[model samples]
Target: MSVIAVLALDGAPGHQLTAPGLAFATAARHHHPVAYEVRVCAGPGFAGTGGPAPFGIEAPWGMEGLDDADTVLLLGHEGFRAAPPPGVVDALLAAAARGARVGAVGTGTFTLAATGLLDGRRAATSRRHTRELARLYPRIEVDPEGAAVADGAFHSAAGVLGGVDLCLHLITLDHGDPVAIETERQLFLHLHAQAQDAGGAAPEDGPGAAEAAYNAVTPPGSSLEPVTRWMEANLHHPLTLDDIAGRARLGVRSLTRRFRAETGLTPLQYLLRTRIQHAQRLLERTDDPVERIAARSGLGTPANLRHHFQRSTGTSPTTYRTAFRALVSGITWPERPEQP
Candidate 1:
């Protein structure tokens, strides 16, 4: 069984404390053979007085709980801007030194940064804090666009949803794609049901009602949801601006203007990004040859796929696959003994 130690600092967000456990429990339920032990470790001076409400939490473990954990997660707290409390930095350093995967969620990156572990590494945090993090730690590269970042054994996430993404990512590294996908599906369904329950009454087709309903679930660019969903469904096809414009029932120029205005990308650019993301998923989950994967992802040829994959991800497709598999298997190939 793998042990995940969540370090809950004073004023820690309730979501951060519970999200990892929820994700791992869902994963364990989906994949019966893999068991996970999630322990919440209270940091110094923690009184569970923070988050959206005032509540009391009695953590089962203390800082020492991180000693033998396979993964140590630092949860965001209200006082993240301040230096970490005594022994917190040392404990994180020791955890990293012992080969445990260390992660931070949102402002928790500040605590990890206090340990200098994030120095000279690309880390992600909430966009609101990216400037502050960079201003404080000039050595660290803050990726505002990334939802989550994984550099070696150190991971960081942007916010609550990003924290969930990070947890699913860790689960993917441990159990591969199917389990992670199932876990995400379950979570999505649960959240959707909750949204419906919270909504209570059916929305009437009054002025602004449609807009409110749309904004409730979708982001700013979601006016083009149908078009984007169609684009995703047909990524295997040779789609062009004309095709997308036709689908959206707009002229090419109009479509380009609206697409860029809403989604901040041209139709072609969005399609390419979508294609690349699809290719990455195929690389992670399938053993198909590069040529087949390329065609399936609408990148046309293996050369085209390699060119874009390398450009977008800074690594070749083959190399990315090998590295990802190594991460999933938890093996460093260089240290493996040669078979007779």
Candidate 2:
């Protein structure tokens, strides 16, 4: 089993502390042989945020818990604007030097930044603090619009939901598509249950109610959830408008209209964007050649992938892979579970 050490400092948000364990535990329960041991390591002066009254958090482990961890995640603390507690930066640096993957959530980027590991890396933080982070750390590239960023072994996320995204991304990297999808489904089901318990109307009431509840937790495109899920699953195929429309059981014109209204893009435009995203993931995670990645992403050929990738991200596929891989060259990834 892999060990994930979550460093919870003073004023750590409750959601950030629990989200990683929730995601990793869900993945382990749903996917065989994908076990992860999560250790909550409390830093000096640890406390929890967000409640009627602030409370102390007694973690099971302390800073030394990071020594043998496979991954160390830092939770954003109230003291982020100030220096991290003494020895926190040194512990993070030691963990990273030992080839452990490191991640930060929300303002946790500030804590990670204190170690100097993020000096030349790209990172994401809450939109409200983007300008402040940039002004304080000019060497780091601040991505204001990115929900999560993975530069080599270091990862950082922005906003409240960004931690969930970062955890899911790590799960995907550890396992694969099947395990990640099942984990996501389970998480969504839990959210749905919570909504229902909070007196939210059930989906059986009407499409309007269902869409509203879904959009409340998920990103936009809840109106066409089924179609969007289908599109993502079949991204490897050369899908045309008729094929997509047929899957939705709608006429071509109606499908186009709904797609535009719900997602602010035409059907083909959405598909292209999805394809580009798929190519990006392949480039980031795999050593696949451009031709193979192009086929898998439905772009068909290296030339086509290059043309669209450059147009979309303003970087060539080769350059992107090189830059992303450079920092990770000497790091060793955690061992994968044996397939059953």
Q: Model 2 lDDT vs. the true structure?
A: 0.75
CA deviation > 4 Å runs, candidate 2: 50-53, 200-340
Given candidate 1, what's the lDDT at residue 53? 59
lDDT per prediction?
A: 0.75, 0.75
lDDT per residue as tens, model 2, 267-305: 887788778767867987999999999999999999999
Clashing pairs in 1: none
Q: In the order shown, what is each candidate's alpha-carbon RMSD?
A: 19.5, 17.7
User: What TM-score does candidate 2 get on C-alpha atoms?
Assistant: 0.59
lDDT, residue 155, candidate 2 = 90
Number of the predicted model whose lDDT against the real structure is largest: 1
